[model samples]
Target: MNVVLSAVSGISASLGEDAVVGITIVILVFLFSMQRFGTDKVGLSFAPILILWFALISGIGLYNLVKHDIGVLRAFNPKCIYDYFKRNGFKQGWLSLGGIFLCITGSEAMFADLGHFNVRAIQISFSSVVFPAIVIAYIGEAAFLRKFPDKASNTFYACVPGHLYWPTFVIAILASIIASQSMVSGAFSIISQAQNLGCFPKVKVVHTSTKHKGQVYIPDINYMLMIACILVSAAFKTSTKMSHAYGIAVVCDMTITTFLVCFIMLVIWKKNIWLVALFLPFGCIELLYLSSQMTKFTKGGFVPLVLAFFLTALMGIWHYVQKERYMFELNNKISVESLGKLVNKENINRMPGIGVLYSELVQGIPPIFSHFIANIPSIHSVVVFVSIKAIPIATVALEERFLFRRMEPRGHNIFCCVLRHGYRDVLGDHEEFEFQLVHYLKEFITQETIMHEAEATTTTVEQITSIHIHTNENEVAHISHGYTIDDTLTKEGKHSSNGSSSGSITMLRVANSYSLSSSHMEGVEKEIKFIEKAMEKGVVHMLGEAEVVANPKSSIFNKIVINYVYSFLRKNFRQVDKVMAIPHNRLLKVGMTYEI
Candidate 1:
C-alpha cells in the first residue's frame, strides 16, 4: 500500500514544477471566465474532450498489459491490499486507507454545478463518464507497475512509447487544470449563500449570464482561493500532496451537512426517526468512511480545517453584532407628544400623506414608525415594513398548498405583506418593492374607507379597508430606484411587513446597505431630501429611512456622525421633534411604537 502511494505521488510530482504552476494559472483564469461562458458551454466543450482523454488513458494501460511480467494478476489482486495492510500494521494500514479519499477533491463540483445539472443529470454523468475514468486511470497505472518494477517518474508516461510520453503528461496537466474550475465555482456558490443569510459581508454576484443559479463570482473569494491554491500547489508541488488539504474541508462539510440534515428533519419534520434513518444513514456512513480515510491530517489535511474556523468566526461575529442592535431598539422607545408638537408647529397642510418605511430585520422594529403614527393620529396612514429572507427550491410538494402560515399576530389597522423571491435571485430590494406593494393594496382600498384584507381565502379573516393613496416614485423625484434580483423564489423568499402609514408619523427605517455604520448615510441624504420635499408640499408629518448599527461601536459611531450632520443641517434648515422604532433584523419582523 505504501509503495503504491509513493508511486502515485512520485508520478504526479514528476509532471514537473512548471506543470503545477501551469495548472494553478489555468485554474484561476478559467474559473473567473467561467461565470460568463456558463455551464452549458463548459459541458459542450469539455465533456467530449474529457471522453477522448479517458479513452487514450485506457488504451495505453491495455497495451502495457501484454508486456507485464511480475505476477500479472497482482494488478488485479484484492488480496494484495489485505496482505499489505496486515504486514504494515495499524499505523501504516491507516496510511494506505488515506490513498482512497483523494477521489473526493472534486466532490464540491457535485454541489457547485448543482444548478447546471439536476440530480439525475449529475448522477448519469458521474456513472457513465467520471466513474469509469477514475477506475481505468488507476487500473492503467497498476498495469504499468507490473511491467516495470522500479521506474521513478510517472509510470503512465513511461508506459507510453517514448514519442507519446511527454504529450500524455501534457494531457494529464490539462485535466488537472480543468478540474480546478469545479472548485472555483463551488466556492462562489458557498459565499453567495453566506451573504444572503446575512452570515457574511455582502459581495457582488452576477446572475444574468447563466440558467445555472449556482454560477456566480465573488471577487474576494476568488482572489483568496487563487492565492491559497497556488501556495499549496507550490509548497506541496503535486496534486497527490495537495490532496490532503482538499479532503479535510470536504469531510467536515459533509459531517456538518449530515448534522444539519438531521436537525432539519428532527425540528422541521417533527422528529420522524424512520424517515431520517431511512434517508440519511446511507450518506452519513459514506462521508464518515471518507473522513476516516482522510486521517492524514498532519500531512496537509489541516488546511481545510483552518479555513473552516475563519468562516465560523466570521458568521459568529455577524450574529453577535445583530443581537446587540436588537438590544438597543427593544430597550428604546421615542415619544409621540414631542412629535405631535413638531408636526403642528410646522403648519403644513395636505389631504393626508403616508410613507412606508422598510427594514431588513426580524427584530427591534424601529421606534420612529410608532412615534409618527401616535403623533399625527390624523394624517392618513403609515406602514412599518419588515422583510424576511426566503428559502429557495423548497421540496414541500406542489400539491401541498398553503405556502406559509404566520401564526403570530399584532398591528391593529395595519398592513403587512410577505415577500418571497426565487432560488435564482440573490439580491434583495426594499424601496422599489414598496411601490409594487402600494399599488397592490390600492386595488382593494377605497377613498373614504379605512379597512382592507390582504388575502380573502378564509372567511373568518376578511379584508380590512384603509385610506386610498399611492406611494409613487415621482413623489421623491431625485432618489434612484433600487435594483431587483432574479431569484427562483419559494412562497416566502423575500418578505416585507407593512403596518399602517397613518398620520404625520416618523416612519424611520434604520440599517440600509453598503455599511451598517456610515454607509447607511449614503442613502440617507436622498431619503431626507424626499422627506423634505414632502414637507414643503404641506405633506410633512415625519418619515425617515435610517440604519441601526448592529454593533455598539458602529451604532455609536454612525449615530454620532448622523447627529453631527443632522444637528448642523437642522440649525441651518428647520427643527423637528419625535422619533420612531420598528422591528428589523435577521428574521423578517418589525414592531410599531414611538421613541422619545
Candidate 2:
C-alpha cells in the first residue's frame, strides 16, 4: 500500500503525505468491501489485469536483458553467491538476505487457494506462466540496477521506459491490490477451516458461490483485516519499514510449512528417514532468512510476531474449552436403556412432531438430550439425533452422506443419524437438508424391513415362534435362533442380529407362506406413516445452547480463559443455530449449564 501511494505521489506533485494516506485508507476500505462478492467473482474481474501486468513485466525484463549486460544471469550460479559473500563482508551479506526474502512473500497464497481452485490449474499456471514471468522480471530489474546503481531505491519504476511509465504505474497499483485480496481470501479460508475443526469460535460464513463450495465470505474477518491493515500502513508510512515486517512473517510461514512437509513425509507417508532428510537443506535456508529478519524485530518485525501470538493464544483457549466440554458430554451420555425408561415413564409425553436434535456425538445419546427430557418431561413423537461430521476430504458423495441407525427399544421411534460432510461441502440450504434427512430416514426403514424379512425366510417357523419374550427394555434378550439383542449396539441397521423381534411372529407367518404378506408390509408401512405424520406436524430443529463455566477447582489461568476470554468470544460469535441456517420459528433451543 505504501509503495503504491509513493508511486501515486510521484505522479502528482500536489499529492502530499497526508493526501497519500487518505488515498490509501479509501483503497483499503474499497478492497475489503468487495470481499462479499466472493473469490470467484473477484478473481474473474482481476484476471485480465494481472495477466497484463505479468506480460508487461516479462516483456520489459526480456528487453532489458537483451539491451543491458547479460552477465547478470550468472547470479543464478551458487559460486556467484559464495563470491558475493566473500566480496562483501559475511555479516552484511547475511543481513541483506532479509531484503531478498521479500521476493517470495505472496507464494504461500497459492497453497491457501487450493480449496477454491483446482490443483491441476494452479500447478500448470505456476509452472508455465507465473514462475517464468517472475524470474524474468527479477532478472530485468537486476540488469537495470547494474547499469544505474543510484536508482536502487526504486528500481521497479526507474527501469520502466519513459513512454509506458503511467500505464505500468496504474497496472502496478491494481496488481498490488489483487495481491492483498489474495491474502484476505486466504485468511477467510483458514478461519472457516479452524471453526469447522472446533479450534475457533463460530462465525457467520456466507457461501458466496453456489457452484463452488469453498468460495466463502466472512464479514467479521474482512472488516477486522481491513482495520488492521489500515492501522499498520498508517503507522509505517513507508514501504521500506513495512518490508521488514513482511519479510519476517513470510519467512516464518515458509519455515513452518517446511517442517510440516517433512513430518508428513516421515510419519504419515511412512517414507524412509533418509528421504525425509532431503528437506533439511531447504529448512536450513529458511532458518537463515528467518534469523536475518529477527535482527529487525524492533524495526517493524515485531508486528507479525505479536499478531501470531495473540491468534495462537485465542485459538488454543477456544480449543481447550471445547475439548473439555466434549469430554463432559461424552462421559455423561445416557445409555439407550436409560433413555427408553425415561421415555416410557407415565409422566413423560411424546408430542406429535419430528424433532431433529443436533449434537456433536456420532453415537449414544448426547447428555443434552437427557437434560432436555429431565426438565421438560416431554419429547417429540419421532426423535432424530443428527451429528454433522466433517471428514478429511474435498467433498462427500450425495448417496454416502447420511448414515442412519435406529435406536433400540424399537417402538419408541428414535433414530441416530451421522451426516458426513467433506471439509469443502456446503450445508447452508436448510430446506434441502430437512428434505434429505426425512428421505433417507424413510429409505433406511424400508431397507431394514426387507433385510429382516429375507433373513426370516431361512429360519424355521418353530425357531421364530419360540423366540424368548423379554419385556424389559434394559436387558439383553436371547432369540431362539442364536441371535442376541445386546443393548450395546445402539446403532441399528448396522448389525442384523441386533434388531428387535417385535414383529417376528408376523415375519415367520409370511415366511411360511413363501411370500411377503400385506400384514407384514402393513407393519413396516405403519412406522413410515407415523414418521410422515410427525413430519406433517412440522420439523423442529433442537439445538443445545451450553453455557460453559470454569470448574470451581480450576486454577486462576484456567478460570481467566474459561470464565472470561472464552465466554466473551462465545457470546459475541455467531451461534450454532445461525451457522446452521435453521429457521428461527422452527428452532428449539435447549439451554443447559456445564462446569468444566
| Best of the candidates, TM-score | 2
Estimate every model's Cα lDDT from 0 to 1: 0.47, 0.78
Cα lDDT tens digits for candidate 2, 321-361: 99999999899888988988888899899899999999888
**lDDT at 50, model 2:** 82
Q: Runs in model 1 with CA error above 4 Å? A: 1-19, 40-43, 66-78, 161-174, 254-296, 323-356, 361-365, 368-596
Find the 10 residues in a row with the least total lDDT in model 2. Answer: 479-488
Clashes of each: 70, 0
Clashing pairs in 2: none
> Residue 371 deviation, candidate 2, in Å?
2.0
